[model samples]
Each structure stands twice: as structure tokens, then as C-alpha cells.
Target chain A: MKQPIGIFDSGVGGLTVYKAIKRAFPAENIIYFGDTARVPYGPKSENTIIEYSIQNARFLLQKDIKILVVACNTSSAVALQELEKLTDIPIIGVIKPGSKLATDSTHNNHIGVIGTEGTIRSEAYNKAIKSILPEAEIFSCACPLFVPLVEEGWLNHPVSRIVAEEYLNFFKDKEIDTLVLGCTHYPLLKSLIDEIMEHKVKLIDSADAIALHLKTLLPVESSTEPVMDRFYVSDNEAKFSQIAEYILGVQPTPIKRVRLYESWFE
Target chain B: MKQPIGIFDSGVGGLTVYKAIKRAFPAENIIYFGDTARVPYGPKSENTIIEYSIQNARFLLQKDIKILVVACNTSSAVALQELEKLTDIPIIGVIKPGSKLATDSTHNNHIGVIGTEGTIRSEAYNKAIKSILPEAEIFSCACPLFVPLVEEGWLNHPVSRIVAEEYLNFFKDKEIDTLVLGCTHYPLLKSLIDEIMEHKVKLIDSADAIALHLKTLLPVESSTEPVMDRFYVSDNEAKFSQIAEYILGVQPTPIKRVRLYESWFE
Candidate 1:
């Protein structure tokens, strides 16, 4: 397939996944849709999330994407199955890759998962880890502020370190050897988290794993042409550009602003 | 005198002021606009914020508001002056009232202010306080997590308490006699903050101060009638209703969804 892969997230956090995909498959064009207008889907109802997920998938499909990546943990937890059913293209979510990494990296059979409240409440990571290593003890905490901190570009601030210390203190006594960065945004705070854990805990970044998975799924004869990444947001392009620049280490391509209600998917 | 008062916030956080205004001036109708569709304005740039603030003001002015309140601290700090120029109505920002309270309530003259990054970076409260009491010692910290936590309705959760403790501990050794809850959302975390401070620090809620200021500005004849409150939002009425019910202790009136860009202020 010569078309780009469609990646969607609730907000800019998915840029983490987009960067990983670009790194792993340099020739594969990428189309990213960040529903920035109504983001933080973590606390929204399942039905509303499913509707949003479907809308996101529809928007991606309109861009002639060969595959779909639900880069948001909240949507992946509650809306992935429905998304798969609604779309014909190969669909991937962050949960499976993260779970596998956690299961493989744990030396003590104890794993810790940290994500948004919706992701933690869904127990999706727990279920995914258990399916692979049924006896693995999974402890999950919802660090809701992590996403906003990353969005605000405060990834390495002293306050970020303080927040990491307070949240990670729970895993210190739990003997968990592997910690899953259940949300893509969590990976941006990896340095702070690692410093707090003193390099003793292995942090699993789902974005890297998902990118690896995409490499295997692509057809052998997939287009070798240089890829182009396009960014679209519902509102505030300049702010999005600033954060995107911080996360991706480069200013993203000109972000096109589109009204959600008027947007149509193929 | 016949026009309603207009208030705008990034999200539901400003409902605190909306509620307070309703209670303080019974006859003065309110028109509240919450940009829930694209919230957390604290992280956006000054230009983008000014554009959004103007758009919000235009939306409310189309509803014939006599005055405008920049209830979101971030917008007030970064875009209030720009908004004032865009509209002819009397404009009020929460920062001035908030700083006055911080200066007046402090016994030791060592006061602390906590808010979103945009607000703190603008130093609006610090400037406002210094303008009044040049000798008062002011300490400011940005508690960026408080807004998202309040939006998630995690007011009294143990984790919320832990986060509050982590954020508030910065003020513990500073011996500040008064603390300004610089963001409207911070007031919702008062119980947890009070618990963390153990009643040693008095908290200044800008919403209350703004309400009193609005009362003083209201026409005497307008105060005789019963108040009517109207709500407006950019998106997700149901989610807004759920959060408003929790924070306001009553169900919000049916919200009117407005296309802010197309609305004419004049």
C-alpha cells in the first residue's frame, strides 16, 4: 500500500506515537489527527468516546490511510474493539505493545502501569499483561496531571520531578521491576521518572513498541517513497505548534485548522 | 442596565464566579461562556489567547452583555487588555480582586499565590499586589495540575489530596500568612488544601472577591429582581452538565451552543 498510516489521539500526546512511527518506518507517510477541540477523553462516557473514536477513524480513513493507530490510551481502552469493527483497515492501539513489554521486562513478576484515570479504570493494561503473563501482579495508578504537564512543556521542571516522586513512591515498596508508561505522554516525562526511580525500574514506552509492531505489519512491497507528515487540529494551531516542536524536536508542518462539525471523512 | 454580565473561562472553572455573581446580584442576569471544547488556555501563547478571548467576548456581546469578566486566570493575565480594547463594555479580571485579597488578608505580609503557568508567568497578581502594598512579600507558584484535577471532579480523592500536599508543601516553610487560589479551579480543591495547610494559611478565592466587586458595581434598581443565569459552551453539553452539577451543587440550565467565530459582538 502506498498511502500513509492514519494516527489519531485525543490531543498532542499522540505526537509521541507519530514520532516513533516516523523513526521506525522512515518511508511511510503519516497523517495525524489530534482532536484538540474536545480533548482529555479520559473522563468522558464510553459511548461518547466511541463516537469520538469513530469520528477520528472516519477522518483518518478520508485521508486514504492504509492503517489506523489509536494513539490515545483512553480511546484504545474503551473504543478500540468498536473502532476495529467499524473500520476495514488494519487497526492498532498502544495497549497490547505496552502490555507485552511490561510482561517481558519484569524480573519480579510485578508490573506497574500509570496512565490517565480512564485508562487505569478500564484495567486494559492489566488485562493485556495478564493475558500474556496471567500470574503477573499488576499495580496501576492514574497520573492525570502527567498529560497536562507534558502539554504545558513542563516535562523536566522541578515541579514535574516532585509530582513524579509523589506518584512513583507507591511503586517503590511494591517491588515492581517494570513500569509501563501507559499513555504516550508519560514517555515525555521518562527522564524525571527514571531519575526518581534511580534507574532501578525499567520503563516501558508503548510508542516505541507500537512503532516496532507497525514495521512488521507493513507489506514487503510497501511504498519506499519519502514520507510526508501532515498535522490537523480542531483549534489553536500556534499553541499546538509550540508543544509539537518541543515534543518532536522540530516544528511540525503547518497545522491546518478544521471545525469538527463541518469535517467530513471519506 | 438591561444587558447581562458576560463571563468566560477556558472551561467549567469559571462557573464558580458565575454562581457567585448570581448570588450577589439577584436581578442581574448572567451570560457565561466556557470554551470546554478547547480548554486549558493556561498553556497557549498570548496571541492565541487574545484571539480566543476576543472570540469569546464577541460571542457574549452578541448576547448584549453590559460588562465582561475574564474569569479564567490565564486569559485574564495574558489577554485582558486586548479583550478590553475589542469591546466597549466595562471589563473586570479576577487577578486584581484576587491580589487585593491576598495583600489585605496576610497578617505577616508574606503572601503566596498559586495559579496556572500563564498566570504566574504574567505576574499579574504580583504586580497588582505590589501596586497596592509595596512592602508585602509575595511568593508565587504555578499549580498546573489543580485545574485538570478539578475538571476530572477528583476534588476529595486521596490522590488529589496527595497532589495538593505535594504542591502546597512548597509554601509550608515560606510562612506565608495568606495564599491566593489564583485559578478559579483551585477553590474546588480548598478542603484538601486546607487540610494540607492545617488552617495555618488563609486562602483567597478570587471568585468570591469578583462577586463582591460585581455587587458594588451593580445598579441599585437592578438588585431588586430575581437573578436569572444562562450558560453557553462551545461543545459537549452533557459533560459540562455533569461537571457543573458536581461543582455548582445544582444542575445547570440548558446550555446554548454558539459558534463564537461567526457571532458579532456589536
Candidate 2:
């Protein structure tokens, strides 16, 4: 029960969830893996996504993790069901948490979701929102550039603002009171998106919801003392450190390189 | 006199150059290496870029290449000098050829260049153009989304067109007479870019220039039949084949997976 929670994403985007978990459950130890070598899972096929997701979960399971969180939207959209069937531990994904938040926040049953192409194309958010609200009007846009922009540490630059404006322009004339930052990377661009939406729309970040869910799922007697956070990546430690520091607003615990399949989980 | 030409890129984007070379030469054998396992070298630092570039070159050198082409713009911008200093073979990058075309095609002295943030930030094309035609006005836009869109095989799709329009809008009022498809991946979206530019601006593809340069630099022998092309990568043969086929408009020759840095060039 004292084992660390395992969090994995295609890249550092999962740090949003890691940070949220740290804030909510300060004493719980965490093991995080960002497959920086093949970070963008959104554009890949379902089979490839499943293979990568299984590898990620297996890697975390080898770390003796109590739970696994697939903190990437693309993977969640395409491989969550298969991932759940593969592992015995609870496997959480960002889509449901984000979809729930959007459905709950929408006053007029109008929700806007922005994520990578894979997530949008999968209609994961749309399906979740529709299943819950039955008649919610869902408008989804794939802001593919947001990931690279965030990775480049350009959260609020002029170009980032311009791009956010261009992508959000699709929702300008539409009536949507709530927008779900469906992709974990989108949270880093919240300020630009919020500014473009005139600060009127409520933005839902799945990280917050996932952290709350994690708190409920874990046992009450879980360790409350600060514990070490470990980071693992498939490649490029220095670049990962730079972006990780920018995204987490602090230097990451030193990142260790692990082969994708060999000796990764254990 | 019989050694094959060596080309390498971070990923399938470099296939643009491979296709051009095969078409232009027909009788010249080529050895291509795509570092699909650790791609998107554009955003990485100079040190990492040099290391990856060197590894790629070493892999190709083992194939007995007469020349080396750094098909990636990021590598050309940040690592070309290092690569040239490290190797004995005549080395070329796509930047110079693309820059030459941009300078030659521009009538109004105004040219636009679009590429990844790494390419734009390095100012490789801008410097190349300025060094050649000091009086030409240059506008550079870092289009981070274009690469991912192309990789997603969304060329000519409505979404791809919309993103292209947003990225290309900066050049519309700049009075540019020429545009350089700075990233090798950009050619995949050439039709959309050409459409958005209203056919008024000439587009320069670096791949074509590299092929021409190779033709001039390497010994030319007209064989009775076309030469066979060989492809190699660090990982994922199936995905590479699909992407290669989509980009080349023809099925890729069988690709062999090779360990990235295990080979020694004698």
C-alpha cells in the first residue's frame, strides 16, 4: 500500500498530473516515466498505441507501483480500454476526468474540447460527455501545435498567443461556456487560451480531477511524509531536464535513462 | 568511384531528399538512415544534435558512402560545422541549397522561410540567404505544427489547410516573391502552401537542390537500368514503411533496422 503511484505520458506533459498528485497527496512517493524518445503518441495507429501503452504500464508495474495513470490524451483516447484489460492495478486516464469536468461545468450543455488529433478523432471526450449529459453539444478541435509550443517553453510568447488565437477562433462564434484542456500539454497554455476566450470560459484541466480521484482511491493511512520523486525517460536527458524544469516550475529530480523494453520496469 | 551517397535525417522527413536523389540520379546508389527512434532533432541543443548527427553519419559511412548529406535542417543548422570538421568526406546540408534557390527566385528581394522552431531560431536559412544576397529582405516563421501535420499524413485535409493558412498568413502581406520549404517535411504540404500563396510566390524544396548537388559532386555514370535504393532506420519498420509510402507516393524498398551507434566507419 506504500508503493509509489506510477505516472506515464508520451513526454513531460504528464508532469501536470505528477505536480497535482504531489500537491494533493504530499507524502505519497511517485515514479514517473516520460517516453521522450517517442513522445507524441497521438498520430500513431491503435495497435502501435496499445503496444507503447502496454510497455509503459509494464515498466511502471516493474517499479512496484500501486496504480498506473496514463497521463497522455492520445494514449487515453486510443489505448485506455486495452491497457485496463492488460493490467490488474487500477489504470486511470485523463479523458474521463476532463470529460466529467466539462459536462459538470457547462451551464448550457455546450462544451469545447481541444487536444491532439488522435484524441479529437477518437471522439473520446465526445463519447464521455454524451454518455453523461445525454444531450451536451460538444465541439472538438485538435490544436496539434500546442504540444510542440509547450515543449519549446513558449507558454505565453507572442507567437504562442497568435497560434492560440488561430486555433481558438473556431469556437469564437460558438456558444461554449466550458472548455476542457483534453491534452495534458494544453494546461501549460491555459493563460494564452484563457486570454483569447476573454476570461469568460471555464477551463477544465484533467490533472486536478485525476489528483482528486487518486486521493479517493488510495488508502487513508498511506504515507503523509514527503517522499522522493523519481523520473525516467527513453532519451535526451538534458533537453528533458530543461523542459521539465520549465513545465514543473522547478528542477526535476535527476532523470535516468531506461531502455524501452529491457530493464525498464524492474 | 563506386561508393554510394549517404543521407540521414531524424525521421522519414528526409525521405523527401531520398526521393529527389533517386529521381534525378536513377543510376546512383543511395544509403539512407532515418533515426526514427530518436527524432525531432530540431528542438534539441547543439551538443545533442552533434552527437545524433555524428551517429547517423557513422552509420552511413559504414555503408561505404562517397558523400554525406545532412538531410535534416536542424542538423544542418547546428551540427554541419561539427560534422564537416569530424569527417573527411565532402559534406552538404539542405539549408545551402534551399537558401540558394530562395535568393535566386526572389524578384522583389523579399523571401519567406518556414520551418521548425529549431531551424528558425538557428537562423540558418536567413544567414545563408544574407551571405549570398545581402540586399534581400527575409521573413522567417517557425511553423512547429507543419511537421507533425505532415507526419500525421493530413496533407490536403481541411484541418491541414486551415493550419497552413494560419501559418502562411504572415507571408501574405510581407510582399515576398519566394518561399523556402525549410523543413524537409514541408514539401508534403506543398500543394496547400502553394494554394495559400496564390501561386504568386515560388517555392524552393531543399531536397531537389541536394539531389542536384549530389549529381554534380558524385561521379555520374549512365547505367542501362535504374539503381536499387536501400533504407535503414533505428526502429518501427511497419510505421516507417507506411509513412515512406505516403511521402514518396510509392512503396518504400524493404527497410532494415540497424542499431543506431554500433557500427564503426573504417
Candidate 3:
């Protein structure tokens, strides 16, 4: 269990999840893969999503990670079940942990989920929440612009505030007590999202939820040296590093650009 | 010359180009492919962009197209030269046609180019403009949100106006007379963009430019029956059709989902 934890996302948005995991287990080394080349898995078909997820998993397994964290909400939503069947290793996805926390925290039994179009369309959050609290009412919206806005480093820009208001207008009348930040890139906008949703709705950041769950399972192991994290991306290392620094406040070192060989998808 | 004209884009953005081409050559059949799965080529690296473009070209060549149309700005920027080497058929890219039109349309010799990060970063329009007008001044910005905004079908949404204002504020101080919509997707936002630019700056849509260029090169042949069109995508046909309908005002017919067979990448 001393091996580094493997985390994968469609793009740099997953770096937020990696940062959370690192903070929770300071001494555990983590390996992160951002598929920057073929990102925005939100609009793609299910077969393509599953194929890329499988290929991503295979790439991380070759790195000998102890556990696989599907940090991407779209991937976790569409490919997690099939991915879980790949190995005996504890393969965890953000949807379940976040869904569980939302259900547990909600007093009104109404939860709001916001993610990429593919995530909302897949009804992953809806299904996960229904499985836990069968009687719970759920509201979901696809906020596709949020990812690009975060990538543009416009987290607090005036335009972002306007976009936030328009997208969250759906939840205003739903009487929801908890709102799930369904996309990994979303937690970066927590303050903005929280402000728009007002003080009543508890924000359920999947990154934080997943990090806490991992900590409980893999209690901090003693390490003599500081934990060193390895970074890998399918494309654009510089852009990835720049965005990583913007979101994580720390630039990942020794970043490597690795190809998810096409044959792996076959 | 009777072979169906082949056109490909990173995604539905190319449908704009397809529509423009069909309008120019009403008697010529067309074959179009949208790589919806691995789209937004605007954020990828040069090597990855070239690789995917080559694979896409290979995939379309298998269908025996007469000429190849690199309808994607990012691909045309990074891979056009290599793509030209692959076949004897005249391979044309939007950059040259659009650049030529921009240079011809400019009154002050100052031009503004707007596109994805990859396209702007590559300086395709800058080079194309400079190649013809060595002293042409170029200002470029990457409007990453426009694609998602259009895909969300928020054509005239209030938030879209705000995002446009933020992205286009760069041109306020510059004395640019011509604006190049470098990415194919930008054409869909033409009306909003026109309103924001104060109706003073001439907007150069690369799709229309490319369409006009193709007409001059591939003159319409006389035909008795109406030309038939076909569409293909690497992923989700339904979403592609939805977005295509939003932009094209008509759903493209006989759409099919085709795989870019892994071997094509090799």
C-alpha cells in the first residue's frame, strides 16, 4: 500500500482533486494524469468516455499505483462501474462519496447537482443520490461554461459572476439544502458558487469528500522524506502547469507528457 | 471532380464550414466528419494536433474524397503543411483563405484575430496576414467560452453577451479595422460579436472565406438531381445534430458515428 495513489481526469480540472488528496495525506505520493489533448469529456459519447477511461486506467496501472481515483466527474459517472471491474485494487470515483455526503447532510431531502453536460445527461448524480435516499428529490443542471471560465483564470471576473447567476438560477426555486460541485474544476469556484447559492445551501465539493474518504481508508503512513508528487498529461504540459499553479497554488514538479497509446483503447 | 468534397473539424464547429461549402456548391455532394470525442483541438500541443489531424485525414481518405478540407482552425494552423504532403488532391485550409480576406478587408492595416488558445498561440492568422502584408499589425485573443456557449444553445443569452465583452475588450484600444473569426465556431457567435464590435470593425468569418475560395477552385458542375450530404462523427451523433441544428438552422441528414480506427494514428 506504499505505492503512489493514481488519479486521472479528462484535463487539469482534476488537479483540484489531486491537491485535496495531497493535503489530506501529506506523506502519500500521488500520480496525476490529465488528458489535455482530448478533454471536455462532457460532450462525448459513452463508448468514447469508457474507452478513454479504460486507457487512462491502464496507463496508471503501469505506474503501479495502489488505488485508482477517477477524479473526473464525467469519467466517474459514465465509466466507473466498468473501470471497477478491471482490477481488485480499490477503484473509487467521486460521484459515490460526494453523493453519500450530500444525502447525509441534506435536511430538506432536496439536493442540487451541477456538472458537465455528459455528467448531467448520464444522470450519474441522480442515480447515485436515488440509490442512497430513494425518496430524495434531485435537481441537476449542466454548466458547460464553468470549466472554460476556470481555465481562463476568470474565477472571480465579473463575467463569471453573471454566468454563475444564470446557471444556478435553476436551483434557486428548488428548495435544496445541499449543492454538489459535480465537476472537479468546480471547487475552484466554491466562493462564487456559494455566494450565488446564498449561505443556506451547503456546498458539497466532491474533491473534499473524496479526500476525506481516502484518508479514512489509508490512514497516514509514516514517511521519512517529504512526499514527492509525479505529474503526467496526455498533452500541453506548460498550459497544464500554468492552470495547476492557478488552482493548486503550487506547481507540480517533474511533469511528464505521456501518450495514452491508441492501441490501449483497442 | 465529382467525388464528394471531404471536410473535417474537431467537432460541430465544422458544420458551419460544411453549411457554407454546401451553399457554394449546391450540386456537389459532401462528406463531413466531426471528431466530437477528441475535440477542442485548440488546447492541444502541436504534435498531438498534427497526429490527430493526420489520423482524421487518413480516415476521410479511406472514403475516397476528391479534395481534403481542413475545416478546423487549430488543425489548419498546426498541421496543414503536413496534411498537404499526404495527397495529390488540393488540400486547402481556412487560414489562408480567411487571412487573404482579412488582409483585403482591412482599412488601417491593423487586424484582430480571435480563436482558440492553440490557434492564436500558433499565430496561424498572424503568419498568414504577415506573409501577404509584411507590416500588418495583428491582435489576437482566445475566446474559449464561445464554443460551450453555442453548444449550450445560449445564442442570445445574457451571459453570452458578458463573456463576449470580456474576451473582446482587447480590441477596444487597438486601431484594428478588420476582425478575423479565426475559429470555425466563432461564426455562430457572429451576431453577438457584431453588436459588441460596434458595427465599425468588419468581421471576417473563415467559414465564408473558405467557402468562397472553394467555389473559385472547384467550380460547380451541372447536375440534374439535388446534391446529397452525409455527416460522421467520432462520438455522439445526437449532440452533434443538436448543436448543428442550432447553428445551421437545419439538422444535417444521414449522420453516422465512425471510429478513427486506432491504426490511422499509427
Candidate 4:
């Protein structure tokens, strides 16, 4: 199938996922959308999050995509099932794969999950980890500042380290062998988080796990054709391009802006 | 004369202005709307900011308000002129009043402004300050992290202090005498910011200036009546009430949740 694979996020955090996808399936054409105008979906109510997520997915579907990946943890945790009902295309979200990977990697039966308020509040990872290992202890904290810190391009800055230490203090008393970067943006802060958590904890980014999971499902011949990547955003194409370069080490070109108004839905 | 005065913010930052209004005109009835579901209007495109502002004003106007205050700086910077045309009621925004106060407060004619990306990029304050004092030097930076830090309720937390220092580093050598708290939420961090600036600079809080300016335009008889204040938000009324209590030292009661979609707009 030549149809492009559609990927969507609240913003540039999903470029990490896009990078992973590109690494695994270099020949697969991709269409990505970052809702930059309305970034940081964590603070919004569930109804608004799901509404915006739906609008984003519809915007991507208009481009004729084969698979749609909900790269935003907020959407994955809260909007995945609703999105499944909206489209017949094969759909996926980061939470399930991330949870599965975290569950598998944990040896001490203690797992820590960190994400935005929306994701942690939904308890998507907590429930997912609990289902696989009923006796496991899942410690979760909503690290809302991480998103802003990452966006500020302060990945290695002392301020980011201070914020990370403050946020990760929740895990100091708990004995956890593994941590899930429940929010996509957290991966960018991996080194700092590693410094704070020390070397004992394994950090699960979920991007690689997700790419591998999708690989097993796609037809063997799907990768035979040369792939092309296109980027789209609701607003601020230049900023998105800059962020993409920071996250993926390559600027996303030919980016177009699309409007996701109520009329787009009805 | 019995109609309530209207105030609208993208979120609780506007409450600073609301508190000022209450202190100055305790007898005047007031209605305030906080778009908590879609806050930090700082990053959204101008068209979206304008559309949302109009919807918020329209929602407030239905209550028969005497004045419409765009308590949000982003809306004030970008949507003020357009809002005046939306209705016959006298419209006011925080930027002009704050700029006027900053101009009046500055001794060396050098001013520094810190706000969300939307506000700083709009140059609303820079232009406003220059119009009255053309030779005034303006230094502006977008502290996008501050809003999230404040929302995380870390006003005086060490993390907030670190972020403030990092963001304010740009002004260290500029030798500005007065600094404007361009975003309303910023007032909550005044003490911490004051500490960072080493108590040398005068902090200009626009809420007080806007309230004082509005006093000149209001009728002398308006304060004779008993005051009644009501709060409304698109979502998370409880959260808004909590923030109001934190910032205003009074929990807003009789807060109603209202939807501001096209249906409400119509």
C-alpha cells in the first residue's frame, strides 16, 4: 500500500516517535501533524483533549493514511478508544506499547511512570502495568513542568536538572527498578533524569518499542517502496521546524498549516 | 447601572485584575470568565486569540455588562482594537494601562518586559511604552516556562526561583529601572522575582494600573451599591476556585461552568 502512515501529536514531542518510525521503516512514507497552536494538552479537560485529538486525527486522515499513531501521551491515554471508533484504519497509541515495554523490563516488580497531568491522571500506565503483573507496584507522578522545560530547549540546563530533581523526588523513597517516560518529551531529558534516578533504574522511552511493535504488524512488502515524509501543523511552522531539528536532528520541510475548527468536525 | 462589569482572562491570571477591581470598587457588581480549559493564550496564533476573545466577550456581554476588560495580555495585545468593534460597551485591556504606568514609573527610561511567547512577540507593551516615551529602551523575553511553573503552584518553590533567575538573566546588564509583569499570573511570583532582581527594580503590576485608570472613567455613583462578584469558567471550576483562593485569598463561590463554542457564541 502506498498510502502514507499518519502520525499526530499535540506538538513537536511526537517527532521523537517519527524519528523512531523513520529508523525502523526507512522506506515507509509518513505524514505527521503537530498541533502547535494548542500544544501542551495536559492541562486541558478530557472533553477538550479528546475533541482536539479527534480534530487532529481527522486532519491527518484527509491526507490518505494507512496507519494513524497517536504520539501524544495525553491523547493515547484518554482518546485512543474513541479514535478507534471513528476510523476503520489501523490505529495505535504510545501508552499501550510503552506500558508493555515497561512491564516487561521491570525485574523488581516496581515501576515508576512520569508524564503530564492528563496522562498520569488517566492512570493509563498504572492500569496497564497492573493488568500484566497484578502484584507489581506502580508509582506515578504528574511532572507537568517537564513539557515546558523541554520546550524551552533547556534539556541540559541547570534549571531542567533542578526541575527534574524536584519532580523525581517522589521516586526516591520508592524502590523502583524501571521507569517509563510516559510523556514523549521526557525522552529528551533522559540523561538528566538518568543522573537524578542514578544508574540502577532502566528508562523506557517507548519510541523504539512502539516502532518494533508496528514492524511486526506491517506486511513484509510494505517496506519495499521508497518512503517520503511530510509535516503539518495547526500553527507556527517555523517553530515546529526548529523543534523538529532539535529532536530529530533534521529539519522537517514542506510543512503546511491546517485549521482544525468546529466546522472541520461537523 | 445595575448591570455587572465584565472581565475575561484566558485563565486565572486575570483574577489579579479582578482582585484589583474588587479592592478599588468593592460595591460594583462583577462577572469574570476564565477560560481554564484553554489557558495560556500566549502560544496560540493571533486569529485564534481574536476568535476566542470575541467568544469570551460575547459570553460576558450576554450578562448585560457595562464594561468588558480583556484581562489577558495576549488578548489585550492582539485583540483589543477588534474587541472594541465587537460591542458598544467601553473596552479596556491591560497593556495600555500597564504601559502607561511603566512609562510613568521608569526613571532611566529603560524598561524590561517578561511574558508568554505570544505577548512578547506581539510587541504590544514595547510599542505602547515607546509611543509615550519614544527614547525608552525596551528589553523583552518570552518566559513560557513561568506560566506552567505558576500553574504547577510553585510560585516560591526553588524551581520557580531557578527559572526566574534563568529567564531574568537577560536583564542583568541592561540596567532597566522598571520591569513590567506583562502576564497577569506573574504577580504571584513578585516576591521571588523581587528577590532575583535584588530589590533594585520597581515591579509594575498592570492590574493595579488598569483598575486605577478604570476608576477615572466610572461614574461616582457606581460604588454606592453593594458589590456582587460571580466567576465562570469553561472547565475546571474547582481548580479555578482554588487558584482564586491562592491568589486573591478568597475562594470564589457561585462559580458556574459555561461552554463558549459557536452555539454559545451565536
Clashes per model (N, Cα, C within 3 A): 2, 0, 0, 0
The residue-level lDDT of candidate 1 at B14 comes to 93
Better of 2 and 3 by DockQ: 3
Q: What is the lDDT of residue A210 in candidate 2?
A: 86
- In order, candidate lDDTs are 0.81, 0.81, 0.87, 0.86
Best by DockQ: 3
Q: Which 10-residue window in model 3 chain B sums to the lowest lDDT?
A: B257-266
Candidate 1 matches the true fold with a TM-score of: 0.71
Superposed Cα deviation of residue B47, candidate 1 (Å) = 3.0
Q: Which number leads on TM-score?
A: 3
> Which should have the higher lDDT, number 3 or number 4?
3
Residue pairs clashing in model 3 are none
**Predicted candidate 4 versus true structure: per-residue lDDT over B60-166, tens digit per residue:** 88889999988999999999988998799999999989999999999999999998888998999999999999999999988888898889998879878878888
Candidate 2 segments exceeding 4 Å error: A220-226, A259-266, B1-7, B29-38, B45-70, B74-209, B226-266
Model 1 misplaced stretches (Cα beyond 4 Å): A1-6, A29-39, A44-68, A75-182, A186-209, A220-266, B172-175, B222-227, B256-266
DockQ: the better of candidates 1 and 3: 3
- lDDT string, candidate 3, B134-208, tens digits: 989999998888877877778889888988997899999998999999888888789999999999999999889
Candidate number that wins on DockQ, 1 or 2: 1
lDDT of 1 at B256: 66
Question: Which residue pairs of candidate 1 clash?
Answer: A37-B37, B26-B227
Ranking by TM-score: 3, 4, 1, 2
| Cα lDDT over the full model 4 | 0.86
lDDT of 2 by residue, B1-266 (tens): 35788899989999999888878877888888887766677665565567778777877777788889899998998888888876698999999888887887889999999988778989988899999999989999988777766765668667667668878989878999899998888888888899999999899998988887777776667887656678887766778998888878887886887642121110
Tell me the lDDT of model 4 at A266: 9
Q: How much is the lDDT of residue A70 in candidate 1?
A: 91
Model 2 chain B: worst 10 consecutive residues (lDDT sum): B257-266
